[model samples]
Target: MSKLKIGLIGANGRMGKAIIQVLAQSQKSSLSSATVKAGSVYIGFDSGIHSGIKETGVIFDSDLVAACKGSDVLIDFSSHTGFSENLSIAVAEKKPIVIGTTGLTEAEKMEIQTASTQIPIVFSPNMSVGVNLLFKLTEIAAKVLQEDFDVEVLDIHHRHKKDAPSGTAQHLKEVLLRAFDRKEENVIYGRHGMYPERDPKEIAIHTMRAGEVIGDHTVFFLSPEERIEISHKAQDRKTFAVGAVKAAEFLSDKSKGLYNMFDVLGI
Candidate 1:
């Protein structure tokens, strides 16, 4: 069987390089093309060499559509702005995409949803298997604990990360809200000067960005006598890259629709 051809966006980025390294070793897929931003230093260079590996003869291109021309699927870890444009390009090319970009607005998310009707898309905030399982465990805990415990979410990331509260943190909020049957407005971002006592109807989320922390998330379920903490700490970027590669492999043979890590992992 032919290897699944993969075109990668953000090819010179940390996650992109990580994915390329994994794909290089995988017997199931091949790196067909790689794309970086226009005028990038790595443009026109061999994708593998740019990613700190031996040359693979796949030159880094500037045009996303051109890079994805013959791919079975495209994996994206680019910025929100870059993805917004590439989303249209992917749709135009009728290519499947696994998107790992975060911090998208509600409207931008809607755009992805709309496009999924026409193509296969596996969109995830954190694509680490452990993190996805953490999501499941958090949901199970929320269901059992119910209203008896006050829920708080804490997320930490590297200083260079662009978004606050992290997409994984926000996704945890969604999972809790679903398990509790609560609405969006019921979540509290954080506390500041002079506020009333904690609201039982709300869950609090706190975010921290500091020195080179890959990613860490903790969900605290606090009660009168005890506190139970469910946490997942990412030691490095390979976990996410591997999960995304798995997502790409899963989506390669699927029909048009929207999917997530749950669909990929069958949890």
Candidate 2:
């Protein structure tokens, strides 16, 4: 069988470089094209060499449309600024896309929902398999603990990461909300001065940006009797890259649908 050709966006970012390395070592897929911002210095550079690997003859460019047209599937790790354009080009070119971008606004998320009716899309905030499992475990714990346990989430990432609370942390928040049948109003960001007492139904998310930590998240459920904590720590960016490649491969033959890492992992 022919290897699936993958087009990558934001080929100059950290995740992009990791994906390029993964593709170079993949037996089921190959990097067909890579895109950077228009007029950027990285344009015209070999994707492999830019990613610190041996040459693979795939050059970086800024033409998203051409990249979509030339590959069997697309993987976008670009910033939220170019997310709509990348998504639009994928829909226009009738190509499946695996979206790993975060920090998208609600409107951009709605755009993805609308576009999924026309083409297959694997949209996920965190693509690490371990993180997804953390999501599942948190849900289970929430269901079992109910309102008896006070819940709080801790998210830690590299200082260079732009978004607060990380997308993975937000997803963990969503999972808790769903499990408890609560609304967005029931969530809290962090605590400040003294209050009367903690709300049993309130879910708290705390974020910390420290030196060079890839990613770390822990969901804590505390009761008067005991405490339960479920966590996942990412040691390398390649974990997410592997899952992104798997998501692209999952969309290789699908026509139209909105899917997530749960779908890709069959969880």
Candidate 3:
């Protein structure tokens, strides 16, 4: 098979740079273009310099259409806004896309859904295989754990992460709800002083941000005797890089549709 030409959006950001490293090192794929902001210092620069590879012949650019044109897939590890703007261009080009961007608004999500009619896209907050497994495991645990146990998800990330509760926490909530017959009275956010009592069916989510921790997550089933914790800690960013590459491989040359990591990994 020919090489899977991947257009990487946000190539200068941490995850974007990590993906550059991944494709350069992996024998399976190559970067066709690395898209950065127009005014980025890295624009017109070789991706492999800071990406730790001498050169892969792919230059970073801010031209979304030129960057994605004729590519097999576009793997986005950029901001929601950048992804939002780039998405339409990808669809117009009929290129597949794998989105690892977080913090998308509801309207932006609807835009993605509309774009799916013309090109395939995989949108997920976190693409780590372990995190997807955590999503699945939460479903099974929530169903069998009985009414007494409370489902609480806790996530910790580097202090620089701006989104509270993290997208992973919200992903867990969505999956856990699938196993329940009824909706909760409320989704209890980080409870504080004068907080009301916890509802048995409510999914409580908590998050901690500090230090340089890569990412650590725990889903707790709290009951009288003890607590059952199912967690995944990402020691490095490569796990996500691998998953993003996997998503690219999954979507190449396919029909138009919206998908997630669960679909990419066949979970």
Candidate 4:
């Protein structure tokens, strides 16, 4: 059998380069091509060498339709603008898409959903299986934890992140609402000024950015005398790469639909 030919978008970015490394390390994997945005300085560079690995002759091209011409699946860890354009091509070609991009607006999300009806698209706020399981666990924990305890989620990302309260933090908030059967109004973001006493019905989220941390998240159940905290920390980008590859493998023969890491990891 032939190896899966993966066409990677955002090949010049940090996460994209990491995916290339993971693919190179796997014998059963092959990169069909890689892409950066048009006019990027990395257009003519070898994909592997660009990722600090031995040369593999895969040049970073910006032409998505041509780059993905012979690919079995396309994996993207790119930005929203690039992804939106790529989605049109993927839908037209009826190819599977594994999107790891964050910070999409509601309209972009709707676009993804619309495309999923035409092509298989695996979508998730966080691609790491550990984080997805943590999301599911947050629900289970919220269900049984003491009502008096305050639920708080703390997420830490790298200093270069542009968005506050990370995507994972927001996803955790959704899990809390479902498990606790509470409304969005009950969730508090920042409470500095003389806000009154705590509300047991509300869940709070806090974000911290520092250093070169890949990602770290914790959910705290705090009571009078004790606290129970659940945490998941990503030490490297390869974890997401591996998880994404697993998701790609799953989509090989699957029908068109939208899926999250929960569906990929079966949590």
TM-score of each: 0.97, 0.99, 0.95, 0.96
Model 2: which residue pairs collide?
A: none
Candidate 3 lDDT over residue span 1-267, tens digit each = 568889999888888878888898777678998888878888878888868779877888888888776467899878876767788788778889998888888799899999998889898889899889988888888889858798888889999998887888877877777777656455778878885566677887888999988889898999989899999999889888889998998888579899999898888
Better of 3 and 4 by lDDT: 4
Mind giving the per-residue lDDT tens digits that candidate 2 earns over 114-223?
A: 99999999999999999999998899999999989999999999999999879999999999999999999989898898877887888999999989999999999999
Against the true structure, what is every candidate's RMSD?
1.1, 0.7, 1.5, 1.3
The backbone clash count of each candidate, in order, is 0, 0, 0, 0
In model 1, what lDDT does residue 35 have?
89
- For model 1, residues 42-97, the per-residue Cα lDDT tens digits are 88899888778898888988888787787999999988887789999999899999
User: Of models 1 and 3, which has the larger lDDT?
Assistant: 1
Put down candidate 4 lDDT per residue, 1-267, tens digits, no spaces.
Answer: 889898898888888988889899877778888989899999999999989999988998988898778898999888877778889998987889999888888899999999999999898878888888898888888888748678989989999987877888988998888887889999888668897788778788888889999999999999998898989999998888888887887788887999888888887
- Residue 68, candidate 2: Cα error in Å is 1.1
Best by TM-score: 2
Lowest summed lDDT across 10 adjacent residues in model 3 is found at 178-187
Worst 10 residues of 4 by lDDT: 140-149
The global C-alpha lDDT for each of the candidates, from Candidate 1 onward, is 0.92, 0.94, 0.84, 0.87
